[model samples]
Target: MSQLFSPLTLRGIQFNNRIVVSPMCQYASVDGFASDWHLVHLGSRAVGGAGLIIAEAAAISPEGRITPHDLGLWSDEHIPGLKRITNFLKANGSVPGIQLAHAGRKASHNRPWEGGKAIFPNEAEGWQTVAPSALSFAEGGPVPTALDDEGLHKIRYDFREAAERALEAGFRVVEIHAAHGYLLHQFLSPISNQRTDQYGGSFENRVRFLREIIDDVRAIWPTDFPLFVRISATDWTEGGWTPNDSVALSALLKEQGVDLIDCSSGGNVPHATIPVGPGYQVPFAEQIKREAGIPTGAVGLITSAEQAEEIIASGQADLVLLARESLRDPYFPLHAAHTLGDDRPWPVQYERAKPRG
Candidate 1:
């Protein structure tokens, strides 16, 4: 078998292959609970042949949601549904993972297809949103209330409780979503973080929230299970968070028990012109892996088998994470095994589709 299909044992969790299902929010949850929609949405991918299947950004608290519809792991009641999905994924040979996130100023918004506007706090279902600074994503976006020391502490507790719930839900991997201009990212960027407090200003100060989260999560997270952090390597805007910042942060995360850096870019700002191209973000993963000495997952438009293989073979990244391509072809990994001429077995039920060897 090639490197991509080789067994990867990190800490104690072992992956059958390197294909990880990148977290893509379904925006389909109801009252922060995963429904039947998520079961089939995620479980089908596991059956389709991904080695690691991570659920979408699950809000740590209700107000932390990107939309009213986001899945959450905040309460004990949310565990049963998630446990069902995780059990299914594990039974099918996929390592179950969850992306823990707080959307910050991006919270209380409608879904992208539903105009994507902020829901006013005075409105029926809307409430106050919080961030490191009182900033909004755009003109129509809500002006989020800045977090006080007490509020920050509350969020930390919220995350801690959610981590406990994730453990109860049978998840093996926990990835803290600190990227995409979310609450954690809001604290990390000078463009958004206008606070004079310790949670803002210098790099160490800006990254303090994420650091505290890693500390809190590591306190509860099983050492045998892997912990990952997804970071936007650059904000793709002038004077925003840069790749150097990511390298420094990755180094700190490694010290904080983070096993991998999922390198994805260009979500802190919507206007910044990203030099978009196929596999454009792979270099970010490459840079972080080499500079920070941490295993990184490369994502963004990595659509083909050869593209994914060359990424691993040439060492651009330790793992290739696919979102859109995986959605387009859920069976890509099985087909890739055939196209790449690897002897990896297909699902027994689908053995007839296997290429003659």
Candidate 2:
């Protein structure tokens, strides 16, 4: 049997296959509410046969959003629309998950198509961003307010509350978005975080914020459900967070009850050169899993079924998460099953289109 098609259980949840839909931000919400676009965008992937479909990063608070239009779970009112999406995913046989995020200094930016530039607080649809240090992501960008003790506590509270809302909204898994130059990643990388407080200056202090957030979230996230953390295994810059740091962090996360580390790389540094290619980031997952003694999900440019199968079969990573490839072909898993000659089932409505052996 193909390892990609083999069932794996994490906590009490059993994934029918190793394929996952990596959370891709839609930037289609209004006042932090999921709209019909999200329902169809996410629901189609579930119907397309992904074992797990992680919803895009939903900001824990309005200010944490990457853009004004980014999805949010800061309020109880955001539950209804999210519940609708999770219900659809679950009913279609896919595990529904969410990524709770805080964008830090990268917040208040225009959508990608709109030039992806920072929007000043005085501008419409923009607000003051916050970070571990008073640094702007780019020159002339809005200078963020350095988060104080109260601010740090509030962020942890926000994350805990978001996980509670995710549970109430019918999500079964919650992956904290600590990667991709977001708030947590900012603190983790010394390049972005320059503070004299307990939340910065040293490796231990930098990870303190994320570690405590996990503790707070796990308080209400339930023991039976699995929790995942997405981390940038390397910042791709000298003097920035490294793979060794990721290995250490993963072990700490495992000790704190995290089930998996979704390993991706090179988004924290603004101008760091990354050797982007097929399976370029797979080594990060491989190293983390081996050194940290934790299961890992490999992501980044892994578009082919053979490559994905090899990753799992070779003991490199336990799961393969597809992002842009899933957008091109939502039914990539179904196609993969056919290519690998695995007996995975297709949705009944689409069974006629399933390839015959």
Candidate 3:
């Protein structure tokens, strides 16, 4: 049997395989609700044989959305649309999951197809962005309203409410989005968190917001269900969040009931030169897993079946999450199984077309 196709259990939930559809933002939701686009986008991946399909970085609050088109779970009404998507995923043999995120100062932007500009609140299709510090991400981006203690509590409350809705939407796994220079990552890195309060100034303080959010979320999320945290294993810049910091954070998260760490890197700074290449981000996953003693998923530029097989075989990561590759070929796992001689079951409907094995 292929290691990638092998089932693995986390807490009381068992995944059918190790192939995960990495959360890729569709930037297609309307008012943060899942649309018909989401159903087909996510459902096809499940049909293509991914054991886990995580929805894109869904904002826990409207202000957390990266673009006006970003997916959201901030309100009760969002549950129905999400439930429609998750129900299909589960029916198609995938454990539906969601990544709850807040874009921080990066919020209120236009979608990538729309030039990806940061729109001002007064401008059409825009709202105010908020963050740990009052910072502007770009020259034209709005200066975020820094969160006071009261606002901080509300943010936490938003995450809790979002998690609850995710449960109602049939998500078995909830991965907290703390990577890619988002709100939580904004708080974790000293480079972005310039505050003098308990949420900044020191390493411990810089990570306080993430730790607090994890604790708050775990309080409401069920014990039987798995909780994962995705962290930027490195900011790829001097005086930024480092691999060592990720290891420490992973250890802490494990103690806080986090089952896995979805490891990725960079995006905290525009100036940082990331050495991008095939499997460019796998090393971070390896480092975090070995040192932190936590299970992790490796993503980024993982495009081929052979590449993914080696990643798991080499113990680089517990799971291989494909983003672009999965988009290009939703049946990546099926192709991979054939290429690796693992010979997994292709759907009965397509068995007649299976390569001669």
Best by TM-score: 2
Residue 18 miss distance in model 3 (angstroms) = 1.0
Q: lDDT for model 1, please.
A: 0.91
Cα deviation at 70, candidate 3, in Å, is 1.0
lDDT of 1 by residue, 1-357 (tens): 777787788999999999999999999999899999999999888988899998999999999998999999888999999999999999998999999999998899888999888898998778899988888888767788999989999999998899899999999999999899898988898999989988888998999989999999999999899999999999999999999999999999999899999999877786889999999999999999999999999999999998999999999898899999988988888888878888777779888877897
Better of 1 and 2 by TM-score: 2
Report the poorest 10 consecutive residues by lDDT, candidate 3: 133-142
Better of 1 and 2 by lDDT: 2
Over 4 Å off, model 1: none
> What are the Cα lDDT values of the candidates?
0.91, 0.94, 0.90
RMSD of candidates 1 onward, in order: 1.0, 0.8, 1.1
Off-target runs (Cα >4 Å) in candidate 3 are none
- lDDT of model number 3: 0.90
Clashes of each: 0, 0, 0
> Which residue pairs collide in model 2, if any?
none
For candidate 2, write residues 25-132 as lDDT tens digits: 999999999999999999999988999999999999999999989999999999999999999999998999999999999999999998888999999988989999
